[model samples]
Target: MRTGRTAHLLFLADATSVHTQRWVGAMAARGWRCTVVSRLPHEVPGAEVIALGTGEGNAQWLAAAPRVRSLAHRLRPDVVHGHYITSYGFWAAACGVQPLVLTGWGSDILVSPRESRLVRLLTGWTLRRARLITADSRDMLTEIATYAPRARLEQVYWGADTDKFHPVAKAPWPFRIVSLRAWEPNYHIDVIVEAVALLRQAEPGAAIELHLLGGGSMEAPLRSLVRARGLEPFVHFHGKVDEDRMAALVNQASVSVSVPASDATSVSLLESMASGLPVVVSDLPANRQWVDAAGGFVVPAGQPAPLADALKALLREPRLAEQMGRRNRATVERQASRRSQMDRMDVLYRQVLGWTP
Candidate 1:
């Protein structure tokens, strides 16, 4: 099949997510004619918006398929790219689209596949049908292979905007530990709180503060954990902030923590690395890829004692943390920059469609 001159790309995503917006924007910036069909109310600036009728899961596709088919007929896109493979890709492939590219976003391959036979079968179907598949981490790529052995899967790390997140002059604060993830169960914010409490016990006058950003269902539970652990004074919940403010906040932190129960590739970890902050992350496969001995410390998941030890060690040796932060930032520049990720994605897209450019 001859590839079309103008690549009409369709992104299927949950309406409110920034990931979809970022992907659409990035593709648009590269001059690909883009359309995003989402359950979101607000439309992205540069793409044609098709509002999805249902919330999420397989049932959503029943309502969304006709709308997607209508758009497919109208647009006649060369490639139909689904953002979350299990949800959107299943529908797109079931609709019989050509040159389908399915991108697996973490939990779909890692956690969702373990739920039930029905979900696993559906997810497997999507993976099998896609002409090409992409995952956010090498770990995720391996996980997806377990279900779809013959599927062509590539690891495409979620890139960070290095221009937006970079090193700033060190702040005069004593010890500021920041977390830029949602207050969700998988994130293990409770572990962070416990670690903070332990840090306080060890160093009574340790001028350490924990900054929890983003919001989720776990906010109340996390707050209660903070109070119960006597971390009310040391922990500050900033809710959610805009991208610019978030970058600033991350740059101000002495170190960043991401003690998730499990993760494929965390955008928060990449963002913190880009901002030149030393990270104390879970010793999961995903985190290990980013946090080497030089960049940051990787602690065993769900263990607050070791996490506290790592945090306290960083706090005690500010210069070592600073050096590690610089290394982390360098790693981001070399591996996780937006340009590098987009370049890999563009190549993959072209390969799926058999296009030279």
Candidate 2:
């Protein structure tokens, strides 16, 4: 049993994000009291949810700030943690909440900063209020340092649950590839389709299948691209699957691909690794940390030729793919296990609260 002074946490984040739900659940399981304050209503097992009912877009957050602040005063949490620096961090800081912890989730720091001067100023100002800031990757920490130079920053991964994502035995059939990233412009899901088209010619008469497992704005256009390339029979779009079904799909595939243009350490990528599948991912600095030469091929984002080559190579050499999958499983167990990362976060909570073992 967990024995310690309980830490009451007030989390500000998007209720829709799987990252937020997972983190809150993990902390609650560890005996921390977690209350989520979100604009969107979500059900996190073991935590109390205060649905702010703030609608879509950034402007809505301004209206929701007063409610958030009022709730904070009444609750008097031991710590206030904001998941996305640009959105939740803005509100947490605006409310003048102290002992705040802010986590930068990739695009919030990388893409949002470039939106406008006001946004950049607001993000930096909020970072200043944070007692500590957390980011998923070392490269992300380097980026956060520019915005909040004096603020303490820690690299903490929102890790994949190893127990839930571990590999299951299955006899392989035709070569199958899974891309679970959303069909958004940023994730470049279209690139996966294009790469599959290129691979068809590289390995003539070879039976191959591409499983696209997400939903986004680019769905219609991605379908058009697949039809245009005459890849309708070869590709299957399984839109926005849940956890259990997604794990079943991953276990059935021989390879996985997540070549987003930019990302922090992806939970999907970690799950793919934990499932003992070799991945073909973008060569971005963040991905480079988890996917090395031993685990899989790293291709340049948006380049079909290299991605096609990587995919074709894996299909041709099944033994090589298996070896990489084994390496990936071991690597994820060592570096990205959810149990280990959550344990680390628990330590940080104690340290922040000045509670000794």
Which sections of candidate 1 miss by over 4 Å? 1-5, 149-151
Which tens-of-lDDT digit does each residue in 272-308 have in candidate 1? 9999988999989988888888988999889999999
For candidate 2, what is the TM-score?
0.95
**Candidate 2 C-alpha lDDT tens digits along 1-357:** 234456698899877777888899899998889998888898887789888877766778777788889889898888899888888888887767677888999998888888878778888888888888899988889988887456678988888778778787766667889998999998888888889999998887888999999888898999999999999998999998888888889988899999999898888999999999999999898999988888999999988889999998898888999999999999989988988999999888777766645
Please give the lDDT score at residue 240 for candidate 2.
89
Task: Provide the RMSD of all predictions against the true structure, rounded to 1 decimal.
Answer: 2.1, 1.9
Model 1: ten consecutive residues of lowest lDDT: 1-10
- Please list the residue runs of candidate 2 whose C-alpha ends up more than 4 Å from where it truly belongs after superposition: 1-6
TM-score of each: 0.94, 0.95
lDDT of 2: 0.87
Top of the candidates by TM-score = 2
Question: What is candidate 1's CA lDDT for residue 140?
Answer: 86
